[model samples]
Target: MTAAKRQFHADVFITLKRLVNDPEGIEIRNGLHNLGYDDVSEVRAGKYMQLQVEAANEDEALASVNEMCERLLCNTVIEEFRVSILEPQAT
Candidate 1:
């Protein structure tokens, strides 16, 4: 991205392959139980990524990030994501 004017931030999530057993989740729940937090039953882990973008406006920034996600970052099949918009940073 060019260091000119607009900026965009993305908070992304990539879920684990469902076929793999969720041992981490089990461990978290077990640990919580040992800590007396018995109400907590399940905890699953996922991936998170943050990105900053440079563009003319929110529309361009979004399109750029969306393209990035589709082409590079996200799997688009197994992984699902949520995106966030941040104020543009001027250079």
Candidate 2:
């Protein structure tokens, strides 16, 4: 008999590498400065994604999500990604 798959929630964060230029981030920072929030010196824009997956365990879920990130969610050349697996939600 096969063990039932469990639902997993993944939070994926995608960001450009530090060496890459972030025009959107710079624009945001400039806007903030114009608004008198000069304390905001730097702003690095990024993407946040939530994914729901089915897997046997946390490890499997993490592996799948990592693969997803490496394959499609992020650009390895100029971007990096981080994955966080939250506790499985109740059915």
| lDDT agreement of model 2 with the native | 0.96
Error of 1 at 88 (Å): 1.8
lDDT of 1 by residue, 1-91 (tens): 6655666776666665676567777898899999999998677777788887777788777777777778888777666556666776545
Query: In model 1, what are the clashing residue pairs, if there are any?
Result: none
* lDDT tens per residue, model 2, 1-91: 8879999999999999999999999999999999999999899999999999999999999999999999999999999999999989887
RMSD, candidate 1, Å: 3.8
After superposition on all CA atoms, what RMSD does each candidate show versus the true structure?
A: 3.8, 0.8
lDDT of 2 at 63: 99
Give the clash total for candidate 1: 0
Displacement of residue 64 (Cα, Å) in model 2 is 0.1
Report the Cα lDDT for residue 53, model 1: 76
Clashes per prediction? 0, 0
Off by over 4 Å in 2: none
